[model samples]
Target: MHHAFQIADREINVALSRARTGYRLHLGERIVPVDLRTGADGRAWLTLGDAHIEVVVATRGDDVFVHLDGEAHHLRYRHPLDRLAAAAAGHAEDQIRAPMPGSIVSVAVAPGDAVTQGQVLLVMESMKMETTITAPRDGVIATVNYQPGQTFDRDALLLSLEPMETCA
Candidate 1:
């Protein structure tokens, strides 16, 4: 599958395909061979050519957080259709929804709570992986519809925010 990701402030195009050995990663202008293994401690070991790197990964909603070699990186993946719809809407979104079916692990906000961009609103576990969902922009939470331990389907409305005027 092909995916577009926003990491830091840069947009990256990645094409992933299964290969006879493991998987092929088409990154930018180069095609690289990729191999993955899970260590006994649960960390992932990714091999690209002769280099071996150990990393921790976590996901929340549409964002991915990777801890690699003691450095932290945040990545956001956007479906092409989502991008197009957002563009057509004429403004960034004020609602946060589940990107996949998951059970709510925790809820960190309530109605009328003020939140900053990137502040975690909840944590959800899906497919045995925990993903933290965060505020997409600075705003006051207008509603929180789920409680801890609730299971929601993909695209289910989890919360809504009344965005700050500057962000609206």
Candidate 2:
């Protein structure tokens, strides 16, 4: 499968093709041979060239956190459909929108609330199913445009987040 991943503020194109030995990893202009094996502890043992490494991976939503060689890296996969929709909407990543026509069942956050990535900010109900809305990244809530029990249309803006400031 071919995928686009945003890692450390850079977009990387990665394509994986099954090979006789294991798999071929295509990264932009470079093609590297790779072999993967699962260890008893559930970690992935990856071999590239003469180097062997063990990596631990955890996933949350569409984001992946990989631990390798005692270092952690965050990877966000941008699916083609999501990229196209973002392009069409011209929306910033900080905006929170309703995924479908739904009534706000609860509001768990308010303006100025500090949120970590993947923290649930609210809950909405559609077709009798409740969906939890989560923070996209670590940030402070900038605004909340809806309240509990309010109805919203699909793609309607529900809230906005401001990036957290960092100390130099």
Candidate 3:
């Protein structure tokens, strides 16, 4: 079985072939192998190369709560394949967007603010789900595109960063 999944605007394709238990993933031209095993606790363990991931999935209709690495991730899984894609997308390395339509709950940063990578910049609420937008790099905020109480569409540009200059 082969399938495609989307998470945070990125797409990934997975194929389950020959061996059945072992699968091939086409992640943007990179072919990777995945192995799944069931442990004594009945949890699904995913192995990718030398790294291992333990996953616990709890679902409520289309919404799912996944626990891994001592952290809880709230996601909406429309399709079974999306679970893998969302997991692979992980966190953003650049700008963050509303995974779904949401309202701005708060603005935590301002224009010209110096923010460290991973610092929270704002909170968005949608379908009773609240998600935090964070800085993806160490830089000064060059622009802030929204304010508290405002609403944004998926892929809306919420902020921009000014790269720091090197001291010569």
Candidate 4:
């Protein structure tokens, strides 16, 4: 099965295949084999590589929440056609927000810096997984809301682009 999930204004594609030993996950060019089992307490055990980690997962509507290590991550399912249509329409989100409670690991841009679409702006870590946040369109950075090591809550505004000017 193939799935797409939206996080931090971008979509990620995942492909899942079952095997006799475990499940194979295709993420872009990387293939990871994992085993998952749920306990009666609702917590799940995930075996990745040689590591066994406990996780909590819940689903609501099109949103899936994953609690790994000590942090939570929310991933929203996106229709593939929706992404194509949005890109074709050239619609871009001006603001980027925290997908879940996490701390900034690094920052690559500051206010007033010019950035292009998909340019890396910052890196954040939640549940020991690092996520890179990127610009959604070509624009100047309008705000720098947090610094490296600063923690943020889910939906917290992390950055914004200067409003595009229009000429009549």
Candidate 5:
């Protein structure tokens, strides 16, 4: 599996690759071997080429914080579907749509409500199964399109979100 990670402003790919000894990284025309050791205390060590580096890693959701060789790095895990969805949504990550035909069971947010990423926005039932709708990012709600007991088709717009302004 190949995973894309955002470090600062750049996106880097690290793949689970096969090599004669173990896993390797594909960097352009170069294949680099990596040796990694992890500890339960969040401390880790990496040996790349002739250099050995000590690192400490902490994570919260998609955000990762790393202390490596006296420097700190923050990164985010970008999902594969995120870019495709953004392109299809015209770069607007505001619209919340239903995944399938369902009826609203409960609503956890309202118009103008502030929500954090992964926070439950509502619950719905389809085919006798319940699912929770969550906020994709931190934002203020713009509209709640349906109330409890309302039925909607697949891909129906459930809500909209407005980006919250940051304090300068």
Candidate 6:
């Protein structure tokens, strides 16, 4: 099984395989574990390479709420496994992805549009919920692949932006 989740504007992918069962994670590095379990109390307990982490996961429609160390966080969705594969496959520097599977509800910019970092680029609808996609850095829109009412898979490239060249 494979999964994807998002944090802020970053995408993370995870791949799980069985027997010798293991889960692989792509988070700036490869993380492999022998076992994983979700507790009845809504916490996920993972044992990987002698490291242990307790994660609390909550899913409401398409929105995910996570709490760790008393800090609450909400994420769209992303697959660390896909991210790892993409990195290994050489897509290291490029536009970011949607991070989760959803329908594009609105596109805020078109090709040739200049945008600043943190600008809202589009809105996506998932499980009846809406999530906004934003620009990660200042750049000009190179392309808009999907539009309003179109559905995309997790990690799907919704748009790409080209960095503005400095004249020096």
- TM-score (all chains, Cα) for each model: 0.49, 0.49, 0.45, 0.49, 0.46, 0.49
Predicted candidate 5 versus true structure: per-residue lDDT over 24-69, tens digit per residue: 8776577778777786876688867567789777899999998887
Model 4: residues >4 Å from true position, as ranges? 90-168
Q: How well is each residue in 97-143 modelled by candidate 3, as lDDT tens digits?
A: 45555688898888778878678888888778787767766777777
For residues 32-134, what per-residue lDDT tens digits would candidate 4 score against the true structure?
8888899898779988877899988899998999889899999999754354325323335666777666899999999888888788999999779898887
lDDT of 6 at 46: 57
Q: Cα lDDT for residue 35, model 3?
A: 74
Instruction: Give the Å shift of residue 5 in candidate 6.
Output: 9.8
Give the TM-score (vs. native) of candidate 2.
0.49
What are the Cα lDDT values of the candidates? 0.79, 0.79, 0.65, 0.79, 0.77, 0.70
Clashing pairs in 2: none
What global local distance difference test value does model 2 have? 0.79
TM-score computed on alpha carbons, candidate 3: 0.45
Error of 5 at 106 (Å): 34
RMSD of each: 11.5, 12.5, 13.1, 13.8, 11.5, 10.0
The TM-score, computed over Cα atoms with residue i paired to residue i, of candidate 5 is 0.46
| Model 1 per-residue lDDT at 70 | 89
Candidate 6 has an lDDT of 0.70
Q: Which ten residues in a row have the lowest lDDT in candidate 4?
A: 81-90
Worst 10 residues of 1 by lDDT: 83-92
